[model samples]
Target: MTWVKLFLGSLAVSLSLVATAASMPDGCNCFCVIAGRNTTVDGSVMLAHNEDDSGEMMLNMYAVPRLNGNNAYLWGEFPGTSVCDHFLNEWGVAIASDGCPSREDREDVTDGGVLYEVRLTVAQRAHSAREAVKIIGHLVETRGYQASGRTYVIADPHEGWICSVVKGRHWVAKRIADDEVMALPNNYIIDEVNLADTLNCYGARDVETYARERGWYDPERDGRFSFKKAYCDPYYYTYEHNVIRQLCAQQYLTGRNDLVPDPDTLPFAVRPNRKIGLADLMQIMQCHGENSEHKFVYKRERPWNHPVGICTDVTVLSAIFQLRADRPREVGCVMWVCAGRPCTEHYIPWYLGISRTPDCWRRYASAAQAVKDHFTAVEHKRDQWPHHIYWKGVDRWASYATDWHNGIAAVQQARDKRQAKACKAFAKMDKKLQKYYDPRTLQVKDREAMVKSINAFTEKLYR
Candidate 1:
């Protein structure tokens, strides 16, 4: 009887762990525009991302040190994980990823590092877009890419690259053309990789051979080895939401009415008719599929249309990285981060050179410590006081907006007015700081002042 009870308890614990792992949230979207394709309104290359996950997860900012004595990198990390979904390093390298689950993922569960681990490794070690591609390829081939597939958008001031990692360590990456712009939802976009174009393409040595062994490709019948057709789970291709989002992205970028959503024929990248800017990117990220007649309708009965929008229920944070090569490193890179839903929340600029995060943005170790700190700074008692002040406030505001439902239009109008005013003020302050302070002469006090000013502005938005 004692042995039977012990065995039952162990079995229950094992099942609980499996259930928890299976429920992990997954979804994200990222877009990149090269320098030539940008409007130069801010004189920088831009990359934007929408990080969707379990709505309850707390998204916090982190500055992690590189073990190899390189420059420390700043990233927006979720609680309990060292892997960063969005990150920018001192060398102007910035990267973001989207989840791409495939059929092969179910069969291949080797020792390759998980998604977060692979992302963290790339963020810590790579300095250039090309270097980042090589590093990810090497890591996947050697250690194995353990998670479902993923698509990474890595960029610097000079260029951008899209790398796709699949199950069993097979991967491929292609550099975005100088004048091209590309966007990725939760699916593999890279098709036939050109092995001969070493400068622009990188892939595993056994990519084709492995696909052949798996009976996924036929060299004699299929003219060339198509990565997407071979590795992307056929079931995902049937998902209407994936196709809807991909179509929406292309329509937004190209502004072409004739374009249709066909996975087989959609170009990986294209040159927009008009140069895109940071503001344009923001609008795209905030898209709710409004213009499409086939998708979301303003007051339609289809609740499914909600998930197809760029802004979704589970979006915890969104950001756009502006990397300027002409400006000094300290002031050149800026991350425009929105704590909650992009549609309701405005972006706050955080400079890459900042030494410390504002108290509100920093996460504490425990609830007790958070309370103690709150008491120490009692002046902020009227505002948020707990350890997760920033997150809690954002969550509350997001809830209010969401609950408004059909009445959200009024809320958005008010928020947009305030956001516009705030944007103007931030632009003025950023310009003044850029002109007044030289990176070489900037002191700790200057940085502190900047942080305080930004924090105050952010607090005003919540109020």
Candidate 2:
């Protein structure tokens, strides 16, 4: 059966067929159902719509992940309350006053056989009931029921916030940098190649081309698009966030047995023709890096533990892989990928463009919490180095870098006439390092010598 017919049929069984058609918003996402679809092997059909005055973008039939659940919906607006510090599991657009509810068995309002509802809210009266139905109806038709996933839209001078669609689904609501706030940045320009495609990776020149067209990178700058600039854009980063978040949530929801109906019952459909798995998702999450390959090398040239770099392509592949085979153990490993080091702090501020790093985010919590868990896994094993060797080497190296950075900061602070006692202490330390160690270059000339000194301690201890 055709997916469009199947979806309409499903709705017919739950609601008045005429009502279903009449109730649908003019332009909202649709969730198509088809036979032999909704598995990694067979695949499912998707109908998504982007409703903006600028354009109405819609995808009629695209293969969607199996774990997306049995019911689908088309939704564009979300209504809820904001609960700061509330822990939401799935990444979607929604507002709640408290974090994700601890209970997963909450009731859902039904429409067209699908389950949904307004779980929490602040200004419920301000948001019209008709709009709520339209939003829910639109969502159900498109994405199906994402357990904790939601998308929100707001009105007026305060624009909506775009959350990070990566590991945590946190907000991406900040203005980039001061310079780029009103200008187009490197990633915004529509070019010969569609930037929204999950699989597209253009070379620096193509990136430069896009930036130049957008006025983000002018060759006149020394950084050559490397330096950060500001530009106000609603579409570029918005699409990036939404696409990645939906894909990642799908990967997790469909792949893990933890989410299955029963321990014995298989939850998702799979496609036999493809290779999809956790490793693939890991690669996808790191797709933003400059590496030609999607692979994230931790021990190589630029070993960034890029938790945020993972993208939609990676998430889609993972969802497909997990649907094909139900692996609870593998899910645990995927959890490790999020919460473990060097996954947490490695990508913060640098890759995320986040100005503030929350203390909770920096510290590791639980493997189940995914990328936020950092304490459990140590990237560098202490046993790998001799006991005293690591201590002496690391401590000395830290002291050196601290002294250098402090020296620079001190000079700048002094020039600004904002010197404090702490700055003076660091300044004094910097002078000592300069006198003892050459200030010509900041790096230690012979790290090997330091290692040799530590090795002597190890030899003596063992001998």
Candidate 3:
């Protein structure tokens, strides 16, 4: 009786394993990196679902997580298992070719293809791309396959951003059913995608253009342009292409810079060609933090109408500066309000051309530490009570004169802390988390403690 019980228990465990395996999306293509090879990948296609978009139709790939900084690569290109919908957003199976697409020009692959659908599987999500690649070999050996022109599979070259199977390119229309998959020619032909699109997609063109213009492409300069330049200025790029606008404004107003066309001289700073003058440009650059777009509407009581294609950070700055230049009385009102204060009221300039960033501003770790230190200092000032207790619902109370001084001190302390401990903590967490913890389950023992720790780390920011 004891032996039978043990056997049954063993059988139950085996059945559970089988069920779990079966429940995972089965019969999908997988890829992985070979040992000691940085660029090459090996994998197999499980053509178990002979028909397109029928009978457990699923596709998956194993690749490296992209390295973003320095040498940017796509996230899917990195070492990881990625579950991609074969029917990309219900548009048909897309096969990205060997290169990344440009942000502005790359056409959507989904818009033209015959639609095929596939489901996602846990194995695809749970396992690393490398492990998936290893298992795919055996899965393919067990399940015989069929030819579907729609199934476009290719390896990625180191330079290639993607191994795309675009809908209108390289593949023919095919029907995928539960029992059998059919392949038929659809007269679709492949075309060479433009490199500019690839550069723009991964965020390179503007920097490339800027670097060449600024003579920043010198090999002696460590063979690299500024990382910040190469990466889209998120402040500007996040909204409209404000860098282009800023450049245009500076060039047209200054008239001597040889970047874009110059604007016609006009009575107002805004030119007929929509270029703004030097004064307005400087004001915008100073006040709006270089990349700011004046998309935010001021209160209704403010006398400002949206400018035509000129409603940007520069426009507002131009308007204010022009007012100050032409009408001194208006300028006096602003200066009166802004003068006398130690820091907040003063017009300090922040520019992108600075050679060094304050240690506090460099990374999140330092920034956080700075914040934590400030909170400590501020708490001490507030009679050892949390600021939240006093300034809880007070909107912009920190800007008040008395409160402002305290806030500034607290911020400086935070910034100092960020430069010291924050950086160390961030580096330690990065190393430890990558080594010891599964990133998915990041919950801590106490939520408030975690929040406090995080707040203390980041509170030292200047902006």
TM-score leader: 1
Q: Give the TM-score of candidate 3.
A: 0.19
Which residue ranges in model 3 land beyond 4 Å of their true spot?
1-410, 437-463
lDDT of 3 by residue, 355-421 (tens): 2223322211232232123212321222332332112312222234334434655644543454345
| C-alpha lDDT of residue 189 in model 1 | 77
* Sequence-dependent TM-score of model 2: 0.20
What digit string (tens of lDDT, one per residue) describes model 2 on residues 1-463?
A: 1322334434433332111111112111111101121321212111111111111111111111112232111111111111111111111111211011111132232333332222211112113212332333333434233232222221111111111110011111111111110111112221222224322211222334544765655767624343112121223223333223223323332332232211112211222223333323333332333232222222222222222333311111111111111211111001111111111111100100111222222221222232212112322333422342223423432343334334534433442342133234323433433332233433344444433432332233223
- TM-scores of the candidates are 0.80, 0.20, 0.19
Instruction: List model 1 lDDT by residue over 1-463, tens digit each.
Output: 2212222323222222211112223233332333332544655777788876642455556555443454567767554332225778877788877766666744343342444445555666678878888877876676566566777888887778888888667899988776767777777778888888998999998888988988888899787888888888775554455666666767877777776667777777777777777777777777767656447323333222234377765566778887776655546777888777777777777667654455555555432343123213323332433566555645565566545467567767976886687678767766766643565644333655665555555455445
lDDT of 2: 0.22
Worst 10 residues of 1 by lDDT: 13-22
| Candidates by lDDT, descending order | 1, 2, 3
| Pairs that collide, model 1 | 112-144
| Candidate 3, lDDT over the whole model | 0.22
Better of 1 and 2 by lDDT: 1
Ranking by TM-score: 1, 2, 3
